[model samples]
Each structure stands twice: as C-alpha cells, then as structure tokens.
Target: MPEQGKKNTLIVIVGPTAIGKTALAVALAQHFSTEIISADSRQFFREMEIGTAKPSAEELAAAPHHFINSHSVHTLFSTGDFENEVLKLTEELFKVHSNLIMVGGSGLYIDAVCNGLDILPDTDLNIREQLNQQLAEEGIGAIQAQLQAADPEYYAKVDQSNPQRLIRGLEFFLSTGNKFSGYMTNSKKERPFHIVKIGLNTDRTILYERINHRVDLMMQAGLLDEVKGLESYRHLNALKTVGYAELFDYLDGNIQLPDAIALIKQNTRRFAKRQLTWFRRDGQIHWYEPDQLTAVITDLESSLL
Candidate 1:
C-alpha cells in the first residue's frame, strides 16, 4: 500500500512483444494488491487470442485484469476511445486501490492515456475511403510512400506495414494540408494520479530469438486456424496487424504457409525494434532487464516514497 497522504500511482509496464511484460505486470499487481488495465491494442479483440499472445488463463487468474479481450474485432476502438474509457476506469479503481498497473507495447495508446492526445479535426470520410481503396488496390507500399513524402516524421515512427495507421496518417495530411506529426503537441496532461513507467528489455539478439520461438509456439497453438476463422474479417482494420496480415496473405494464396510464418517472425522483430525506438525517446521510463523484477519493485517503492 502507498504511504498515507500520497497520491495514487499508475505503474505502467512497457516493452516489446515477447519481452515478458505480462508476467512482470502480474507480479507487480500481486505485490501491490491492485488490479491491472491492459494497454495492448492487439489484445483488445477477444477473437485474436493465439495471434496476439494474450495472457494465459492462469496468468489472468493470478491477478485481476481489465481491458483484456474486452471488445470485439468489429468494434472500431480508437486511441481516443481507449483514453476516455481507461481514465474513467482508473478513477473508479483509484477509489479503492492506491496503485494501478497498465501493461502493453502500444506506445501510442499508452501515450494517449498518460498524456492526452492532441485533438485533430475530424478526417473527411470520403478521403479516408479513397485512401482505403488505394490501399486495397496498390498495397501498403503505395500509401507508405505517400506518407513518407508527406510526413516523414510520423512515417519514421509508425509501423509501416499497418494499413489503418498509414491511411490515418495520409488522411490527416490530405484533410488538413499539414503533416500529421505536426499536430502532435507532445505535451503532458496533468492527471489526478502519479505515474511510474518501467521499461523491460534485453539484448536484441536474445529478443529476436524469443520472438521467433514465440511465433513457433503460436503456430503450434493453432494460430493458423485462428486466422482462418477470421478470414471474412480480414479487411477490417483490426486484422491489419503483423501476424494476421501475414497469415491472411497465405490463406489468399499470395504466399505459402512456411513463407508466411517466416514473414510473421521478421515483421514482429521489426515491430519490436520500432517499439524500442518509440519508448527510448521517453526519458521518463526506467529501464531494466525483464527478470529484474525485484529491483523494479524496490525502485517503485522508493519512487512512491
């Protein structure tokens, strides 16, 4: 428990995929005797269990968790949607718990909740549809090139393979005639609670190996079948992710199963690299090896003091 008269705390555990964030968050939640809110955008859909690497039954049971499999793929949940919901949820949770845990690799969603997102003008739906049509016809590379020319700053940071994000960036530029990255004020919002960010990482080679092994495990766990089940929804923005998108290509006869699996591993590694780049820019995060849970707990205690 926090010391008397101290503000409530939100302990955010952020790292790349396959970096053991779920276990660490659960451990911290148990120690603090509080609940956790998941910031993982991929794990928001209940149908994407195998591919998203969601927490196992045992892990979820080990600690009370919110926002894990809390929505359907059909729902269009945005960063702003998440920010509003989580802020409200945190207010309710803080009424009884002094410390709350949020864990995920989605840097944008994390930033949305921690620092309020900049309000951009509503995008023109006609422009958005046109961009989506272009994406469907010319592939991600075409729109990616557009974003690179229009807004190199966000292009450098965004996951280039994600069509939804590419379209959003392109639509923003087309609608406002300004770079999407420029709209981001990067200003921190004052929250009612204190925040402590803990980042877990390890050697890049080791991280890649872990990612490869995890993908293999996912394949064994019926990730292919899970993708098959969602074939009808492949065009949805929710399915425009690394694992699902690669496998969807295989199902469409665009690539072989083996090639698709390999691409998933490669793309996931790239995603991890991008995640590291995003989090590294935030100097507020305290870095540690994934296994350094004891040291992290000690640091958290001292910070709360």
Candidate 2:
C-alpha cells in the first residue's frame, strides 16, 4: 500500500501489441488491489472483441476494469474525448485507491493522460464532412497520398491503415496551413499524481512470431465471423483498423481469405513496430521483459513509498 499523503501513483503499462500487456496489467492491478483503466483505443468499442484481444472473462473477473467495451463503434470518440474522460475517471478512481493501473499500447492515449494533449485549433465542420466524402469516394489511397504530401512526419507515425487518423492529419493541415506535427511540442502537463511508466518488449524475431501466432488464433476463434457481422458498418472509422480492415477486404472479394490473413499478420507486425517507436521516444519509461513482473512490483513499490 502507498504511504499516507503520497501522491496517488498511476502505473502505466505500455509496449507493442501481443506483448502480454493485458496479462501484466491484470497481475499488477490485483497485487496493488486497484482497478485498471484501458488506454488502448481499439479495445474501447464493444463491437470489437476477438480482434482487440480484450482480456478474457476470467481475467476481467479477477480485477475491476474500466474502459473495456465502454463505447460504441458507431459513436465518434476522439483522442481529446478519451483524454478528458480518462482524466476525470482517474480522479474518481484515485479517490478509492491510492494506486491504479493504466495499460495500453496506444501511445497517444496514454500520453494524453500523463502529458496533456496539444491544443488543436477549431476546424470547420464542413471541412471535416468534405474530407469524409473524399475518403468514401476516392478510397483511403487518396487521403494517404494527401497526408503524406502535406505532413510526411505525421504520415509515417500515424497508422496508415486507419482512415480516421489519416483524415485527421490531412484535415488539420487543410484547416490551418500548419503541419500536424508542428502542433506537437510535447510540452509536459502537470498532474496531481505521480506516473510510473513500465514498457514490455523483446527480440523482434520473437515479437513477430508472437504476432503471427496471435493472428492465427484470431482466425481460429472466428475473427472472420466477427468481421462479417460488422460488414454493414465497415465504413465506420472503427472498422478501418488492422484486423478488421484486412478481413473486410476478403469479404468484399478484394482478396482471398488466405491473403487477408497474411496481410493481418504483416500489418500487425508493422503496427507493433510503430508502437515501439512511439514508446521508445519517451525516456521516462522503465524497460522490462514480460517475465520481470516481480522486479517491476518490487521497484515500483519502493518508488511509490
């Protein structure tokens, strides 16, 4: 337990996808007798279960969790919205527990809670509507090319597979003649509690293998059926993600099922690399292997005290 009057500690778990983040988070939350707030934007939508690799019923029942299946895919939940909601939720959770766990591979969402998000200028709704129209009419390639030309830096960092992120980058540039990357000063924001960041990673070969195996498991677990059920909603930004996007391609006859599965593994590997790139840039995070839970708890307890 944390000492009296010690600022509440938010132990943030971060790393590449399929890096055992959920398992580590559950263990830590249980040990600390605290609740978990998921920062993985992918896991927020209730419609996305098998593909998101959400914690199992047993794991969830082991610890009280917040933000898993907390939103609908049909609704638009921006990063700014997630930032505000998580901050308020964290404040409330802190009131009950001195230590809490916030876990995810989504660097932006976690950063939003630890360091405030950049102040974005208001954009014209018409501009957003036009961009959405362009996306629907011209396909993701159009938005990808535009964003790459306008802001290559954000283009390389943002998920190329996600149309929503791509459109946001292009929209920001069109709205203001400034690049989206320019607004990211990374200026630290003060929070009421102390943050302890823990990152999990391993050899790239092993990580890729893990990602491939995970994709195979998702297929065996009926990821195709899940994507099929959401077919009517493919146009939604929520469906523009790695697993769903590739499967949607198969369902649309753009590719065979085998090819779609292959693409899922390939795209997932790329996503994990991007996640590592984002987290590596932050120097505050303590590095650990998935097996180093004991050391993390021991060192973390000392730091909290």
Candidate 3:
C-alpha cells in the first residue's frame, strides 16, 4: 500500500445529508471487521440525537462505533480538538484492525481530521461579546453583510445560518487585518497512515426526496419534543444546527409549526448542496453511487493488496 510498511489503511466515507452514508459506512465496516469513527459535528453532543440522525442502536451494536453522542453541549469543542482526538484514536484502532472506517456528512470536520485546518488566532472575548450584542440588536443579516464585505469567498461557502461561522471570519478580519478565508488556504498535510476516500452520490431529485422523507420521519419520531427538551440550551453554539434552528423558531412562536417543519426540509436541502460543493473540491476522492458498494469495496481491497 503506497510503499512498504505503510501501516493500516483508513477508509473514509463521506457524502451529503440523506445520501445513505451511514448505512454504507456500517456495511463497509462490517466487511472490513473494523470500528467506525464518526466525523459528524452535530452528532457529538449527547443531547442531540433524533435531529442529528445518529446511528441507530442496532447499527451501533452491529459494529463498534466511537465518538457519536459522546460529548456534553456545555463543553466547547473546536475542529482542532477533533483533529487531535481522531488522530489519536485512529492510531489506537490500528492496533486491532487493519482497516478503520471513518464517516460523516460534516465536510469541515472530515477535512480537519484528514488535511489539518489552518489555526486562526484566538479572538478577544470582550470583542466577541460586543459582536454578539450587535447580532442580537441587528440580526443575522447585519453580520452576514459584515462577513461578505470582509471575506466574500468564505461568505459564499460558510454556513450563513450559523452565527459562529460569521463570528469566526469577522474575528480574524478585525484582529489580523486579513480575511479568515485567507488563512484557510487548504494546503494538504502529511499523515502517517494511508487514507482511502470513497464518496457517495445520487440523483439530485432522489436525494432531495430522501431528505424530505427523513425530516418527516424525524417529526414522527418526536423531533419536536427533542428540540423542546433542549430549549433551555437553545442559545448554545452546539445546538445551533439546521433541524434544531427551524424548530427553535416554532418553539419561540416566530413561525407556525408546519412552516418550521417545511423550513427544516428546505434548509436541509440547501445544506446538502453546500456539502457537495465542499466535497467536490477534493479531487482525490473517488465518487460512486450507494449501490456501487461491491465494486467500491473490491477496489479498496485491491488498493491494500
């Protein structure tokens, strides 16, 4: 594999939301007799389950899984922390399994683990407090405009709905006289183990339908109650995600329940589009439909031979 004494290989399965990434990852893990390391940012919090679409109990029992729903919402975790933890865990997993599977739809988190993100300078908490005050008084549109003026390229790609993303870009711009996007140049980093990337894709219409249906199912499984339970922590950065954000509006009487549900579906679709854009930028990834598992697995085995 690549050369002599390459150690164990890492199989990374990545795709957009509702692309059946979890199922394929589990299947591949079973085939390889290995455990899974989750890269999902939202799925890290223990309280966020149904909305994050975490792996089911049966699936978790089928293959040993790590890092899913294992953190407290109160604890702040950065991509740098994730990169450190996953790298350490991957080395440990190598002791037992020759091939370890890592999977998720969170493109940035995956990038952090595989290709180290740029370390931005820390921001002043007082400045952060002032920015939060501005966000509260002026709303997201005001912050969006600020970020766009500072880093239009990042504004195009960053999650506009997430205030944390905006704060990060602005913090860097205000502190360093340079856009945060400038620091994130995405130069590849060296890793000790071999990494094999497998991408999953499907027809746009089909993927959208799956997303809509999954949102409906989340509702059926009491996603509204799940959000309601976390209402006390709604302001937490960890809880500020697509499904929970829309439902939070419904909880606050800002929107009708049905409208909030519809908005969740719409936002989820847009998120899928962004995920595709991020993943497509990596030319090293070998793409395939979900149904191409047999051929994909065959190629993976051949690569290690």
Backbone clash pairs in model 1 (N, Cα, C under 3 Å; residues 3+ apart or in different chains), count: 0
Q: Estimate every model's Cα lDDT from 0 to 1.
A: 0.92, 0.91, 0.87
TM-score of every candidate relative to the true structure: 0.97, 0.97, 0.95
Clashing pairs in 1: none
Tens digit of lDDT per residue, candidate 3, span 1-305? 12346577889999999898889889998998889999998888999999999999999998999889879999888888899999999878887777889999877788888888876677667777888888878977898899999899778778777788888788778777887877774587888888999999999999999999999999999999999999999878877778998998898899999999999999999989988988998897999998898999899989977
Q: Is candidate 2 or candidate 3 better by lDDT?
A: 2
Instruction: Write down the worst ten-residue block by lDDT for model 3.
Output: 1-10
Q: Which predicted model would earn the best lDDT?
A: 1
Give the alpha carbon lDDT tens digit for every residue of 240-279 in model 1: 8999999999988999999999999999999999999999
Model 2 root mean square deviation, Cα atoms: 1.3
Clashes of each: 0, 0, 0
**What are the per-residue Cα lDDT tens digits for candidate 2 across 1-305?**
55677799899999999999999999999999999999998899999999999999999999999999999999889888998998898888888899999999888888888998988887767888999999889989999999999999888778888888888888889998889988874587899998999999999999999999999999999999999999998889999999999998888889999999999999999999999988998999999998998999999989987
- Cα deviation at 192, candidate 3, in Å, is 0.6
RMSD of each: 1.2, 1.3, 2.1
